[model samples]
Target: MGKPTGFIEYLRELPVDRTPTERVKDWKEFHHHMEEKKLRQQGARCMDCGIPFCHTGKLISGMASGCPINNLIPEWNDLVYRGLWHEALDRLHKTNNFPDFTGRVCPAPCEGSCVLGLNNPPVTIKNIEAAIIDRGWEEGWVVPEPPAVRTGKKVAVIGSGPAGLSCAAQLNKAGHSVTVFERADRPGGLLMYGIPNMKLDKKEVVLRRIKQMEQEGIKFICNANVGDNVEPQIFLKEYDATVICTGATQPRDLPIEGRQLKGVYFAMEFLGANTKAVLDGGAEHALISAQKKDVVVIGGGDTGTDCVGTSMRHGCKSLVQIEILPKPPTERAADNPWPEWPKVYKMDYGQEEAAAKFGADPRVYLTTVKKFVGDEQGHVKELVTVEIKWEKNEKGQFIPKEQPGTEQTRPAQLVLLAMGFLGPEQALLKEIGVETDPRSNIKAEHEKYTTSIKGVFAAGDCRRGQSLVVWAINEGRGAARECDRYLMGYTDLP
Candidate 1:
């Protein structure tokens, strides 16, 4: 603890985000970095609590309690406070292979479990983490560090999402020849396509990491579909071992009446195309445009918010986001105690942008869509919605029950379905002959990562179901360690 009483002296403060109204016009990252002095002060606020739950990485109440990758948060906080920037990065890279990604996108469950958060505001751990990694890049401290020796054993990693990238990176670090296969044209699976550019700049942030990985001797083969273009049996012929990091990508669909109407798309279809358009030349070249159209975004999650933001950029005439669940409380509920992920209400970047432009939050709570109304051309024109209440069924599971006389119609030209994924697509798993759980996720033991197949392993959303980026990294690293042990009968990966 560089500053023993620092927690009492400093208060939590984050860098001001670019104003919503101004930022919506351009596709740039909206978050501004804090100055070094303020970042050091924020780092100093890490308390000397003996049991620092900030990095405990436990699941409480079925949600993440702290850093899922077990990041040495307090150690790096102290390192930053002592003005040891290089050492801070060393400690950060020890656990998280990509702090830059998690620092931008992770919900920061670590802060929810911070000891200082019992009464006072928690330390700005997320901001400090982003600062540390961003600093490392600025100072040229981050570069390729290929292993000094090669083990001659080759490993193939499927899917270039967070899990696959981390798994490939770890296996490469263990001196094994690693090759990553991506179905998309680009390497980053979710990070490249799922997230919008304004949230995380693709050319500057995501591609930069991809280039670094390439320089480190990890080969990436793009547009390679194992079950289709590439043979699944190639693993047993060439690679010493295979690791499946293909993510949960099967989006849940709203199969109500008129679902076949035109102008309705899944969130990934909209988001992925937009990024591809931006990378191709200009956002104006997007496959589907929301310009001058009334947009209705279904499902209220990060993907929904991304749809709202993307629509705003496309100059949509009207925007509304529908959430079937009730609005969360402004503060933590009694049942959501400290150290648990607080189910508190906070406007994300998209909602803030919508509120600034539309004079209100765009989300409609306690509402469910009954059906999509189509025009003569068979394109979506409007949708009917109804208010609903949660009721327990005979199985003791909560379900939404629509209220009578509450149905209403709203005009919409474009509809984006952003409900969460059900599980990974089954084609590749079936071809690979890996067993799946009842929930359709790959059936591999959590820490062990081994599957029914002798040389095959699974990790990330494919194994654990859809989850946060940090958890994907944790699973990927764990799978790498286990795979290394299986390959050599001794594991050295951490």
Candidate 2:
């Protein structure tokens, strides 16, 4: 404990965000960093709990309770509080390969499980983490460190998302030649396209990391679809080993009346194309646009929130988000407590923007889309929804049951289905002859990561199903460690 009373003296604080109305005007990041001295004070709020749950990295109640990468949170907090930023960055990099991405997008399970949160607000761990990494970049402290010697072993990584990138980076650090294949025009799979630019600046953050990885001797090949353009046998014959980080890209579809409507689209098709157009020039080539239209988003997860935010930026006339689950409580219920993700009502950025523009919280819980109504041109014109209740089925599983006499219809020119992903696209897995689990995810045990095929391993969403980017990094690093052992009969990478 740097100062025994530091936690008592300092309080939790974070960077202020730009006003929703102002930030919605442009697709740029809104959260501004706190001044350095203020940030150090925030870092001082760390209590140095003897058994710090903030870094436990355990799965409690089926959700991550702390830093999944097992970041040295307390050590770095102490370092930053003492004005040792360079040392803080070093401690952060010891575990997380890319704290920049997590600092922005992660839901901060660490804060939720912080011991201090039992009595007061948790330490501003995520903000401190982001500040340390951003400072490292500004000071030119983050640079390529290619291995001094090559191991004469080559590894092929399919997918350029966080998992594949982390895997390839770790293998390269161990002196193995690594090549990443991405089907998109650019690398950084979800980071480049799936996520909004305002949350993570692609050019400044994602591409910068890619550039460093390139300088570190990791090769990235774009526009290469492994199952279609490039044959799986090529990797098997050419590379010493292969790692499949092809994330769960298959979106769950809403099978309903008028599903073939023109304006109705999957959330990724909308988010991916918008990001592409943003990078290319504007939304000129965007396949779907919500401009001057009533937008209805199905699902209430992060992806749905993203859809709402994107629609607001497009100047949508009105917006409504529907979720089948009931609304969470404003505060944690007696059944729910700290050390687990609080199932409490909290407004995300998208909801905040929607409220600012539309004069209401757009989310309508316990409601589901029943059908879509389209105009003569087949473009969606309205959405039919109904209230639903959870009831036990014959098998004792809770299922959504539509309530009678509760049908409602609303104007909606654009309908975005952000119901989440099903599993990895099976074409590549089928081509590679890998077995799949019951959920259709590539069948690989956690940490073991080895697929049925010899010298072929799986990690990330493809293997474990949809999860956080931090979990992807964890699986990627674990897969690399096992792959290294497989290639050289021993391993050092972690």
What TM-score does each of the candidates earn? 0.99, 0.99
Clashing pairs in 1: none
Candidate 2, residues 1-494: lDDT per residue as tens digits? 67778789977777789999999888888889999999888888888988898998888788889888999999999999899999999999999999999999998999999999898888999888999999999999999999999999999999999999999999999999999999999999988898999898899999999999999999999999987899989988999999999999999999999999999999999999998988899865677888999999999999999998888888999999999999999877887787887778989999999999889899999999899999998888998999999999999999999999999999999899999999999988999999999999999889889999999999999998999999999999999999999999999776
Q: Indicate the residue-level lDDT of 282 in model 1.
A: 82
Whole-model Cα lDDT of every candidate shown, in order? 0.94, 0.92
Q: Compute the lDDT of residue 133 as modeled in candidate 2.
A: 99
100-136: candidate 1 lDDT, tens digit per residue:
9999999999999999998999999999999999999
Least accurate 10 contiguous residues by lDDT in model 1: 48-57
TM-score of 1: 0.99
Q: Model 1's lDDT to the true fold?
A: 0.94
